[model samples]
Each structure stands twice: as structure tokens, then as C-alpha cells.
Target: MTDEQPDRKESGFKETTRVRTARERLRETVAGHDRTERVPLDAADGRVLAEAVVAERNVPHYPRAAMDGFAVRAEDTFGASDRSPEILRSAGEAASVEPGAAVQVHTGSELPEGADAVVMIEHADERGGDLEVFDAVGAGENVAPVGEDVESGQRLYDAGHRLRPSDLGLLKSVGVREVEAYEPPSVAVIPTGEELVAEDPAPGEVVETNGLTVSRYVERWGGAATYRDVVTDDPDALREAVERDSDHDVVVTTGGSSVGERDLLPEVVSELGEVVVHGVALKPGHPVALGVVEETPVVMLPGYPVASIVNAVQFLRPATKWAGNLPVPDPPTTDARLDRKIRSEPGVRTFARVSLTDEDGERVATPTRASGSGILSSVALADGWVVVPEASEGIPADEVVAVQDWEALP
Candidate 1:
């Protein structure tokens, strides 16, 4: 772990910290920050509200016909029946209805000025320049009153509420064109490795996909992501990349986080700023690191695809939520009995990929066959992951576990 000799086997970490400790440090570092911007209602879907939204005007501000019928005074149609009808003069398309007069109106049309109710077209008939009413009408029946849907000055949404598609429609109905919402956290995703290539890779080279995957997840989690190209395993290059993206709310780097000689992010992060938690006791992604540079959080992830994804969900997801003044909720989970025993270390937290199937009218979770840090298909094809806590060794067969859908957006 000395400066002159780079550690090859153990990656300089004498003892890895627990997963809970690492998450607490990261949450504490990036909490209590606010950034807001005005967003149009059309683009406000999934954005968090910066302030409470109050309606400026009522929905359906004027009384209108709720059904296709004739507008008439309620008293004029009193005691009307199918056998003996009340006859009134027909006032075609009248702006106002007088006594013993009926106005022709359609659904959603404004009620006439003097009209207090509407007699359904089926209950009334126009015959020989007169209207025959066969049913009695209440004073306000079949009319959409003012503020029927939403009252004026009503609180639509409070701060930190995430806007959905239906929410935009309600806002538009209340005459709100835009809203003041917290801006999505900006993220700079850097993929670093000497053997990574953009497209066609040679024998030893690998295609760079971690940056793309992580960047898309950032957007899904309500953040803006800037995916960067691959940087070689050089201290100067890696340091410059980290400094270039220090202005972003979060800097996530995939690869170059292990204890091998090529892993140089830990050293560079320590030199520029403080490393909050370097190595965590988490299976398949324990090499992940958390640091802060110029007050912006930097997350160092393992090069393996599965490991990178695992750490991103555990660390980067919550980091963005805290920075944007949004709610950090848990992912959706389902309880299922284990089909077979799953092994894990006693003190390290493990995320075992499992695919669910119904057997004997019960949901059973079976661990994926290729359960390795480098295996990507193992997770892509699985339904969810079962988390083994740091307390116990592993879950025995027939034990129920919560299968967390890790990719579920918050």
C-alpha cells in the first residue's frame, strides 16, 4: 500500500468497510442540496416539484351541459310525464331561456343564462315548433357546475412530489403552463480502462458498454447523464478526466477500481479530494469506492458489468435522489421461497441473482447458473436479486427471501 510500490493482490485496502457504513457516508456527504429550474408541463413528467403548486383558476370555470339535452327551466317541466307532456315554445340556439321556453344544447355546451336545468333529449322532443317534455327536472340536474373538477386556489401538489403524465393534465386544466421544479442532477459517467474499445475490440480488448448502461440508468432515476469516452490507465489522463467533470453533481467511473496495478482511481481521488469509503464488504462489487471532489460526489465502480450495475443501484441512485431534493424510496420486491441453498460470506453483503417460477402453486426463486461478477447475462435474464445481509451466512433451501427488482425506477 506504499506510494512507490503499487499493490497487486490486495488493492491497498487492509479491511473493507461494511455496506451500511459506506452508504451512510455517501448519504451524509451529498445531503441538503437544492437546485431548481422552471420546466414546462409537457416536459415536467418525472420531475420533482421545488415548491407547492396552487391552482390559479377553477376547472370548468362556467356551468355547462353535462349531457346532450335541451336547456330549460326546472319549473317549466314540472309534473311532465310520458302520457301527459308539458308543451313549451322551442327557442333554437337561444343564448337565454325564458319562462315556458326550451333551448337546444349539446353535451359540454354552456347552459343558457336563464336556464337552471337540462331535460335530456330522450325525455323531450321537438314537434311542430314546440317542445314536449315527458320528465321533470331538478334545479341543477345534468349540469357541470363551476369548479366541478378542481376548485380555484386548491393545492395540486406539494414540494418533492414527482410529476406524472396525469399530473400534467390536471395542471393544464388548472391553467398552469409550467411549474417550478428541482433540476435533475447532472452526472458525468467516465469509463476507464486500457483494454476497453468503443466498437470492434481485438483479442484482449473489450467493448465499452458500462458507460452507456450507467448513463441510461441515470436518466431513468431522474438525472442528466453525460457519457464520456474510454480513458487509458494513466494517472495524468484519469486525473484530468475527474477534474474536468468536477462541476457535475456526481462523477461515476467504471473500471480501474480494483487493487491491481492498473487500478489507479483510488490514488488519484485521494490526491485531488477525500475518499470517504474506498472498499466495501459487498459481494461482486466490494471494490467500489465513494469519494468527494470539490464538493461533488465521485463513485468508483468495478470494471465488471454486473458489478458496476450492482454498485450503481446501491450508491449512484441514492446520490442523485439526494442532490435533487427528491424522495429516495426502496425498489419493488416480492417474497418467494428459495428453490435451493445460496452461499455467501458471513460478514459481506451479497446480491444473488434469481429467476422466479411458480412451482406447486408457490413462487420459487432459483439462483442463476452463471453467478459471477463478470457475467452480465446472469442478471439480464433473471427476474430480480435476493440480498443476503451481513449478519447471516446464507439462506437455506425453502427459506423465503425478498426478491428485489433492482432496475425498478424510483
Candidate 2:
């Protein structure tokens, strides 16, 4: 084994602790390199743009009327209201021609020459071809001037922006039909273990479900997922699998991350590539292996379901964002008072499952007992997870803590 490998006892526990700040680990894992590609605007939904999108023309290119009313000078009806009505000739005297005239206008119609404002049709009455206006209108009212919605030569969107429905509408309004966006990164997931089988497993073997979980998350974040056949603790088979799938942006393997006698993922990765970070300082996912195999990033996740998921959130999400030329949003969180006390190690950050409930008009958090990575059911029942940092020993009851809602995942 290389000098970077941690010493593990027969009981599956490490001899020395390897603690790293979340930011440090993330920086060490990602090197900021990215691959770019172009895609059609219709398929660019939720994808990040690699270049800035400038406006070709101003929105609503012409000044137009916003309501169906009489276009007249504000000075014509200075005090015209319900109490005092102003009478004026509808035709040649005030310049009128049915609905399309120099004085009368309809909704969204162009303003006639010499007209500056529109008085609602309801506010005026016909009196022998003349009009009696009761409401006073202001100049430039009910009118959308040119370049009011969008200015000419404006920077509509910047690079690294993920397109949403509203953003698509803005692009369309500005006459942009296509865009240059980065292609999503492709991720290959390899599940390892002898007793583990596919979802439909044989007798005495457990079904492998971590790949499915990982794949779902990768696609959710605009990354492609590729699932490979299972490798049963054989270093040569694992090496071959990594080599075959080296074209992918990221390769994630479940199980065999620790230094157990049967665990050989670390050794295989070292032989094929260089291991940058052998372990993390977080609970339930400390044995994670982060490295690069032939210029492609590889992450070896722990076997337990919960541990695998936590590692994905911490490492895989950021890596996927970097590869796809996207920016990762801050993890969704809400502050709530803790209902019970929770303990943790001083050097390791702990994630505890929690359920939120309203009590006395305030949110109270109730923690779950499934703290281990193997217990997947507990996570299913939890609304979110509360984070405890590395420097703190434990959080006391009624302390406000940040909780991540599981439903926020797409």
C-alpha cells in the first residue's frame, strides 16, 4: 500500500484520524478544469451557459398604447372628473375618426400623431358626435415607450447562469433563439462487493441500490449517469472497469473504500492513478477516496447507503458543477431550535437526521436514531438533516441549527 493509505484494524476502524475542513477537502478534490459544448436553446433548460448573451434589439421596439381610450393632450382635461365634465368635438374639431383616429385609440394600438396620453373609453360619452370626458388623464400615462422593457445593446445574461423558465422567456423576448451552453458531464458508477447483487439479487445476496441513488442525483444536477457491471473485490477487474470508463468526467465506485483486507479500491486507484485525498473528516463518510485516474476524476464512496449519499452531497455535487460549467447553489437550509441534545466528536462534522414540526408558532427539530450510514430507512423517514460542525462537541437543546430538507433534491 502507498504511504497515503490509512491503517485499519481487523474490526474495520481506522488507527489514526484524518480531519479536513469541508472547504479544504472540496478545493483539494476539484482542480477547476472544465469541458465546454454548445446546445440548442430548447434543450438548454437548467443547463449553464459558457458565454454571455447580449441583446440584439430593444424589447417592444415602438411606443404603443396600453389601453382602449381616447388619446388626448393632458391640458385638454385639466379638472375633468365625475363632478365636472369637459366637452370637446369628436371629429375634425378635436380630430377623431371612429376608433382609429388622431384622438381615439384601442388597447395595444399605436398612438396617433400629436396624441400623448389615453383616456379610457368608459370615462367619455358621445354627445352628437362630440365627446364629454369626465376623468383627467396624465401625459405619458397608459403608454409603453420604446426601450422601456429592455434597452438596446444591454447584457441580458452573463456566463455560468443556469437557465430557468423565466430566463427562457427573457431570451425569447430579446430575439435570441439559440445559445452556447456547456454539455453536462458524464459520470460512470461502479458498485463493488461479492455479497451484493443487482436490484434483482440471488439468494443470500443483498440487492445493490447505491448506483441507482447516485445516478438519480447525477441526472438531477444536469450530469449524465453511466452504470457499469459489478466488480466483486477483484483488483484487476476493478482496474479494467476504471480503464474502460476513463472517458467519463467522473467515476464513482461504491464499497471497498476502507482499508479492510478485502477492500482493494484504494490500491487499484493508486496503481491506475494518483489519490489526492484518501479520507475526509466527516462522519458516516470518512473513508471516501478522491483521486484522478488518467485525467478523469474518480471518487470511491463507502458501501453503506447513507454514507454513500452524504459523500455524494459533499464531493460529487461540486465536481459535477465544475465539470458542467455550472455554479452550485448553497444547500437549502432553515434555522430551527433543537428539541434534544446531540453529541459528536470534536474533529469530525456530524450529520443527524431530523424531522421538523411546528410548536407554539415556531419550528422545532426532532432528531432520528439512524445515525449510522447503514440505516437507510431512517433517512427515508427524515424531513432533513441537521449539521454539527467539527469544532463543537455537541449541540444543546433549543439551539438554532441549520437543517437541509431532503425534499429540496430534484
Among residues 3 or more apart in sequence or in different chains, the pairs in candidate 1 whose N, CA or C atoms overlap within 3 Å are: 11-259
lDDT of 2 by residue, 1-410 (tens): 54445444343445324444543554554544455777666777898887899887787776667888777766687788888888765754244333323276777777666777777889988778677889888888888777778877889888888899888888888888888877788889898988887678778888988888888888997888997778898888889998998888878899999877768887788889877676677877888877788888888889989999888887787787776777878778888899999888887888888888999899999888767789988777888888788888989988998899744753
lDDT to native, each model: 0.91, 0.78
Candidate 2 error regions (>4 Å): 1-35, 79-83, 88-109, 112-114, 120-130, 406-410
For each candidate, give its TM-score against the true structure: 0.87, 0.88
* Candidate topping TM-score: 2
Q: Distance from true position, residue 346, model 2, in Å?
A: 1.5
How does candidate 1 score on lDDT? 0.91
Alpha-carbon shift of residue 317 in model 1 (angstroms): 0.8
Model 1 ranges off by over 4 Å: 1-14, 31-35, 77-93, 119-136, 335-337, 357-364, 398-401
